[model samples]
Target: MAPVPKTMSGILIEEVGGPEVLQWKTDLPVPELKDGEILVKNEFIGINYIDTYLRTGLYKAPLPLITGREAAGYVVASSSPDFKEGDRVTYLADHSYAEFTAVPDVSAVIVPDDFSTEQAAAALLQGLTALTLIREAAGIKQQLGISQGPFVLVHAAAGGTGLLLVQILAVNGAKVIGTASTPEKLALTKENGAAWVINSKEEDVTARVKEITSGNGVDVIFDGVGKATFDANFDIIARKGTVISFGNASGAVGPVDLFKLTPKNAKLVRPTLFNYITTKEERRAFTEELFELISSGKVKLRIHDVYPLKDVARAHQDLEGRKTTGKLLLKV
Candidate 1:
């Protein structure tokens, strides 16, 4: 085993505010390992929208909290026999924006031999998110219902989870339509297997979607942009369509009227990843599917950018400002 560093660096939020609230310090102690836990010497940390919500206080946390959710690293110490020193692992959990992390053994998954640390860091959260939304949330069962052909519309098509979801749907033989803000993003969406791409900023999304589906709308819509696109999202669904409202990147969505769904006989559901993988059994099942997808090349991990761990504030600013197109990571 390599000698572990005595102290580690981390990003801290002093108060809930703008990007200015992010502070970095070098003197923090490495997280102490607990029973059933392993200490990881983090090599890369994932930058996600949830991290931004935590920093801005939109999602409340204990004041003066370390902020980060996903990271990939080598195990340095452990109380559990499942992981040994020098094993490569990754996890999606809070408090990972540091040089070292003490994570429960169950929460961490060993990276496959084919994947690098960077890919492991970028894939865990978004890949799992995509898996849950498709298999669990939207319920893509053994056979897709629509003989006319099943269509899935994904908002924020160029994002991490969106890209993965598009591929997953495509491999499952669904006609996938995606919405993005720029031509570049639209092209990326197409590269990721979207059958159709709509520039939601410049194009009338509802009109384009209707035109693409020949006025029938789609069978399922995976919406994460929230308030900014919810109305248009609602307008584009077919009768008996299913809408899965997952994340709020633009802002919180409506206090929706259940009556609205009655007119179209549609179903409205709000799903979080936590609910989908509620039990240990469910977690294993979902993750196994996700790993199989990646290992089999049915899904590809898109890494948009990588920055030093100390550049967490810049990463947050880029993501919140909508300046990035795919997954972002911090190289520790």
Candidate 2:
């Protein structure tokens, strides 16, 4: 093990704005561990759309915030019995874009021996999100009631969570349709097990979806694009189809008419990872399933880029510019 630094470098966002607000500082104090906390020397940090939201003021947090939500590393010190020095772990928690981070032992998941730190960090958050959506939110069953075949639509198909969602839905025997903006992204989505890939920019999404399903439409649409894709999603779902709108990458989805549900007997649900894994039991189940999937090679991490900790602002810029095809990371 390398000698722990007394002061660590981190990306600090003093105000919510554009990428310019993310300032890298090298002299920040190494966060001290509280009781039941473990100090991890972060090897890789996950960059996500939610991080972009926080940077752009779409998702508000305290000003002058240390702005990272996921990472993987080895425990350097521990005040918790569950973890000890040198145990490799990954977590979806705040303030992860640093050389060292203190996280509650309960919040950290032990990475399998064969998994690299970078792979663990890249996969954990998105994998867990996919698990919650497929197993809990959508209530995917052995046989979906009233639906002849399970068909699902996933928006932002090239993204971290979206790619995992594609694989998970496919493994559950659902015909998965994924949407992406470019040919490269579409190829990536297809490689991840999507049965169909729609170019949201070129195709008339609803018409294509109708044509694909022979006009019956799909059983479920997992939309994270919010305003830009919601209407098309509504148009293409089969009667009583469930629309799971989980994010707002385009912009915040403001309001909708309750009567919209009455016409087709359709339903809409807004689910967050926080809600699905709220309890320890639920969190444990979710992680265990995800770990099994990854270990068995049923799912793989789509890590598109890894930047040094000092270049976090550039990572955020790439994320905001929509240049990334999959999960981005910060090497700490």
Candidate 3:
């Protein structure tokens, strides 16, 4: 292995506003490992909507931050015995839009022998988000009770995390109804195992969902579209159903009355992936299940594009514009 360099290439955000704030620099300092952290030479970084939120000041972070949540690469230095130099890993961490990241041992997982760094990067964050959204956030199994398969709805069904949700829900035998604005995305959703796809652009989503569910409404709603689709989720959710609002792709939802969920006894939850995998055991369990699904061909991750680190601004532009579908990655 090469000696670790003091300086590395990365995107540094000094101001918060738009994609333009993501300025690429060659002289950014490589992060130093903490006692329980490992230094990874990042090969590929995952681009998520959270990155966009942090970049635009929608989500708060300090100035001059290196903003990204996940990356996959080879460990180059370690402050813990669980990892060593040359171990391939994918991790959930801070400051990932860079050539290297200091990853907490609790949040990092070794990439399996069958997976590539690109796959690991693309799959980890969004994949686990999908898993935890279904299992932890929604509690699909317990919610289903004796029902063989529950009716579930996923907003932005062709998007990165949306696609994963559709596939994983299908694998668990849910009848998934996915929403997309375009025919291409609707088709993509169906291809990924959605039992039905709603063209959120042209159709009345609430009416269509009512008709599909025979007026019972869906058992669970995985809503990542945020404010744009939040209200409709209540209208289309069945009695005692769960609504997991996991992202703010269409902007954050406003204050809730809490009374809206009262009529149907609906359950509303806003879960962040990080909260679900706080401990090492939790992270490892979810990550292992996600990897097993991918490796077994039960779930597939779609990489929309791999942008150069310097081109992160354009990537963010495409993401916020809703111009691309599936996972976006940055090659370091």
* Lowest lDDT 10-residue stretch of candidate 2: 141-150
Instruction: Give the candidate order by descending lDDT.
Output: 3, 1, 2
Error of 2 at 81 (Å): 1.0
| lDDT per residue as tens, model 2, 79-161 | 99999899999987898878889998878989988888888998877788888888877888544532344889999989878
Q: Give lDDT per model, in order.
A: 0.86, 0.86, 0.92
Q: What is the lDDT of residue 297 in candidate 2?
A: 89
56-106 in candidate 1: lDDT tens per residue?
Answer: 887899988888888999999989988999899998777998888889887
Question: After aligning candidate 3 to the native by TM-score, how far in Å is the CA of 253 from where it should be?
Answer: 0.6
233 in model 2: Cα distance from truth in Å?
1.8
- Model 2 alpha-carbon drift over 4 Å, by segment: 1-3, 142-149
C-alpha TM-score for every candidate: 0.95, 0.95, 0.97
Best by lDDT: 3
RMSD of 2: 2.0
lDDT of 3 by residue, 1-332 (tens): 88999999999999999888889899988887789999999999999999989988899998989999999999999998999999999999889999989988888889999999999999999999999988998776433422478999999999999999999998888989999999999999999999889999999999999999999999999988999999989999999999888889999999999999998999999989889998888988888899999999989889999999899999999998988889999998
lDDT against true structure, model 1: 0.86
Best by TM-score: 3
Q: What value does the lDDT take at residue 104 in candidate 2?
A: 86
